[model samples]
Target: MNDRLNLFQAARFGSPFGSPFGSPFGSPFGSPFDLAHQAGEYWLDAWQRSVLFMDAMRQRGDDHEEKLTQAAPHVLNFEFDVVMDGRDLARPVNYSLLRIHTPEGVVVDANRRPFIVFDPRAGHGPGIGGMKHDSEIGVVLRAGHPCYFVGFLPQPVHGQTIEDVCQAEARFIAKVAELHPDADGKPALIGNCQAGWQIMMTSALNPDLTGPLVLAGTPLSYWAGVRGKNPLRYLGGLLGGTWLTAFTGDLGCGIFDGANLVSNFESMNPANTWWKKEYKVYSEIDTEAERYLEFEKWWGNPVLLNAQEMQYIADNLFVGNRLSSGSIHDSAGRRIDLRNVKSPVVVFCSWGDDVTPPQQALGWVLDMYQDDDAMALSGQTIIYALHETIGHLGIFVSATVANKEHEEFTGAMDLIDVLPPGLYEAVFVEKTKDTVNAGLVDGNYVVRFERRFLDDVRALGGNDQEDERRFAAVARLSDVNLGLYRTFASPLVKAAINEQGAEWLRQLHPYRLRYKLFSSKSPLLFGIAGAAERVRAQRAPAKPDNVFTMLQEAWSRQVVGVLDQYRDLRDSAVERYFMNVYGSPVLQALVGLRADDGRVRQLGRDIARETVAASARAKLVEQAGVGGTPEAIIRALLYVLRAPELRAADERGYAMLRELRTHSEEGKVMSLAHFKDVVQQQAQILSWNEEAGFVALPLLLPPSSAEREHALDVVRQVAGAAGELEGEAAERMARIAAMFSAAVKLAG
Candidate 1:
């Protein structure tokens, strides 16, 4: 019995490779009994330590709960007026106008066209877009655009279809347009997250209602991602397709809880959700936790969607990828064609966003257009901007991002308007103290945009025919399963559920249970009131060397790390398992799925034809005479391309230009009219470059070089001015100057 006990002790603490109890002296020659005793002592100490640690955690949890309850009133008191009754809260000020007030006292000028900001109805409530002065509404308002928020009611209107909500949004836009008959531009629409795609559908159906659109962190290309990167895309397959979504909705008796959506988002980053978010709050509980709790109050409070709506989203948008494929249609048989949108689309996405990655955000650009030529042929202008590292919500909600990215975009709205009907990428660059070309007239930051081929966008997200094939199979299976549910189970479920029962079920939901239990009514929580007050009073604040606190922090971090690794492992296993199961020939046969189908084949062909046509059209426009010949247009484009560089080197080029005096004497006069003509000609030749030259020439050229050396000197000084030439405009100006210098030398 003693030997057996010693053996058990040895196994508990020692490495598995060697037995310490056998020899009775550690190893072959050593006293294994001594080692076993030592091991036993270590384990006993560890067990005691673990017990104490757990007790500490229990006490900490109690304290945390107390602190939370104490702070709840201040943290959860959201100040916005929901009824539009014109009542001002101590926090959120209410307004009747279709405009949001900025902290800077800048009233956004509303256009007759009507601006609508559709906030994502995820787990959170309204005001993310206008939470700070540097937010989406703030940027729009600063630009003098009238803004209206498409906020939801605390409780959803009964029998609300997504279609009904869309119709209501359209009506709101129409009313705004009616109000502003004389506004300069049409109402610009901005949608964040889910709202982004909703607006797209709205615009598709009512094509004429919207003008420009900004879709921030919205995933249109749901199936897009690189390997190991977008694990969320693989989730539906692992969970036996979207049947779970349908099942949940059915169980809710026609209303699906939005908490599931929020929970899914949290699950993607266990580290952030489980530990980092709370730890950051605990570490700075005095101040930072207030904002954290405020956000959580909304995040934890989820809205409900009709089962039909949830099922529709799951089947069509998430799993099917039907929106981008043009496979989705309304009841009226009108295909939801994104290409029908006449206005420009600005897509803003980021690398750090796991929810709506750059691939999902921008991949649809590729999905919609075959090439840049097709984009121009369709008279569509798509501009996309990529951030290095901002999360999904941060793309629209973060104030710093809003001030920089959103502000720059809003400031350059007009530039985007006149950007010619083509695909382009907008890049925001910080200007140094030394950049000398002509276009940049602002601060340290300048937005530099370049015309990009659709192929470039496609390259960002690689083609995965295999994945698409798998998704198609999932779609087919979903349709089959949905049919089975409707034919078999749905009828019984619907007959059994009543309005009261549904409401009861929703109240009893796990997500809502905590909120209901904790709010003022529970008798069990009465003691919590006084306990919270005392805990707040006796709060032992953080210090650098508190060992217990340090251990707590370290343990918290370890827990988070373990959770993260577990999530990653789970994601990988699920993805692999699904790919193996769903990608099988047997499953494909069962579902009557084909890897390559007529729809995909037709889509490919359509893409090819569109690309060819667009290329030809762009080529025609590029070769079109500024006035007469193809060569002249080509020359004009070259001239415009080099204008900015030449302008910058004008001083250096002026020496050569001084040699052109003989030519100027010989009726080769450098007049403002000729310069203007050259710019206009260049603009017309390149089609898109036409505006660049037109805008550039007025700013680039002085009245004349009539005084030769004096004019040249003034031109050089103006050209050398710090803020004068910047961005693409500066580059174009320099190129023009270079071309002129070459032309002059040849003539000489």
Candidate 2:
């Protein structure tokens, strides 16, 4: 085998909870009957567990329905008051804009910028983003920001499309701004998963309406992913394109089931979906029930989408992969171009997230601009933070994630905005115990922006033009197949199914039935409650040493492994079939696929306009980069800060310092906006050409010792407020101090 293959084989599997039983083989001398005696005892213990397991399942089902019934009509995870109903809008939809009512003790700073969050409407109800106290809303509330939530009804308006939803969200944001007129700036937007793209589209359309944008686990560049991973991206092509999606929506008789979307997510990892998730719960039901049921409440409350909405997404987004390419246009002929958004964009995604991988989250950067210089020339500040091992859901909802990543993200919004237009990877910094002046820090962890380039993003995505062509061909085929299906099968299917029948079919879905069977209505589970009580009173769970218990675990693991193997084999077959069928040159030619698969078919038209505008902006960018003293001062501070190779606290300290100085007695004489403009422009110029920017510092600052001394003091006051400087940080500060001192001594 090749070296790579050997490496893969070795790394794929890890020792599982290491076999405590040691060997399957037992005492060789033991008689069959004696073993049978022990086995009988083990069987009784196992039987008791079975009774308890059944009882737990029934209670879970009961809880599911009870929660559903209580949450009827609208189920919200956080407390909020309807600020403005969507029905009041000229173009109405079954959505609402809510102003979250913070808990009594949770202090909210009315002057602070408002945060508007939108949860993904992909197959699940809203509130996962704010379901727990330790969530996005929770984090925002803790930070004293007035929070807002944009949520939708369970059923969509009869003919709602993605465009309509975007309009409503834009309206909601505008309303949020109106409500917070006293606030410092426009409301910041945080969109999770599918909502991530929705907000981006809205931002592009109404660039002036929103503030900083945070997209968590959002996939803008759908086609960008690593090979041998992100298998779900291939499913659309494997399933013969979105024709099946249309057919499925028709079968639902106008409303598509979100449960199917959830199922698709589950099918991606059968080991987790079929066994591990449930096994973990079953193994620790005593302490697991509340948490398991809490998550299930959100997972199980699948929402419905109008057939129009689903088709629009599947065709335009999944099949066409058009959002990142600027191929999607709204009804009014306004191109929904992402580059139009001027707001600072912060992307939070994890490398472990299979649903929306890092490549998909970041790949859009590489696709949208020709290079990093092109991006900066456009005057956009894009920051992306990557977590090492969190899953897709954890990116937004995990309490640990919220407390650290999201807290830091929200606190640094101002800092992100003040940053010069460029590309950066936000890296987390470890906190030292002895850091001084902790009062300025907003969160536990510090984050530093590490300058990066388009190359870095493209490297992760490995933009394979070959794969692009295949997907393009698939899109072409999807159009053909969808046309055929609508002409032939769509009418017949629609004619046969009614809303009533569709509801029945939905209820009968295995996904729904799993919970229904545990309801009090199920005859088989009538006595489970009583039996569970008895089992609970006389319970005796077998320990790990029990032979039968060991055997059961072994058997269960084998079954899960077999299911995983089948899943892998099936996925492999599907991928192979898709590639073979779509890989044909003839098929590609028929679809008019070009050398680069028309991946940037629209780039020629878009980039030319961008280039001319960028050219106009270039002169300004250069001047800003090389401006006099203010630019030099910021450059010097940034150089010292970065020299330590340590992550400093949030950029908030710097932005705040600028704000505070502007309002100070001395600051009253300075133009805050002009100062910020100078700082940002100078910082960018220095970053673009560090060596020259460094050389120009002394020329910009006064040659006198008193003035130089005063500048250094300000830098120390601002940078040190967030934390004490040590190690490389201290060294860099010392170098700056010495340089300023030398200037004065030499002058004399």
Q: Pick by lDDT: which candidate is best?
A: 2
Off by over 4 Å in 1: 1-98, 101-104, 110-114, 435-444, 535-540, 595-748
Candidate 1 residue-pair clash tally = 36
- Candidate 2, pairs of clashing residues: 436-724, 625-685
**Model 1, span 1-748: residue lDDT tens:** 5543443443343344465533423453235554455445445434433333333333333432443344121111113322232122222211122344333556655543346677777655545676656678767666667666656544455565666566666665676667677765566788899989988888888877876888999999887887788988887777666777877777777778887888789889988876787566555555564466445545555666777778788888888888888787787787777887767799999989999988888877777766564566566778888888899878987888988888777766644544446666777667665555424434345665566776677677744776666767777787787778778887787778787887788777675565455544555444554554554565544333333344455667678879888988988887788678877877877898755554341233346546765675566453443232222322333343334332121222222233322223234643322332333334334555554433343222222333322333333343443345557656655655554444344434
Candidate 1, run of 10 with poorest lDDT: 86-95
TM-score quality measure for candidate 2: 0.86
| Candidate 2 lDDT by residue in tens digits, 267-321 | 8888998888877666665667668777877787788898889999999888888
lDDT of 1 at 569: 94
Query: What is the overall TM-score of model 1 with all chains considered together?
Result: 0.72
Supply candidate 2's per-residue lDDT for 30: 36
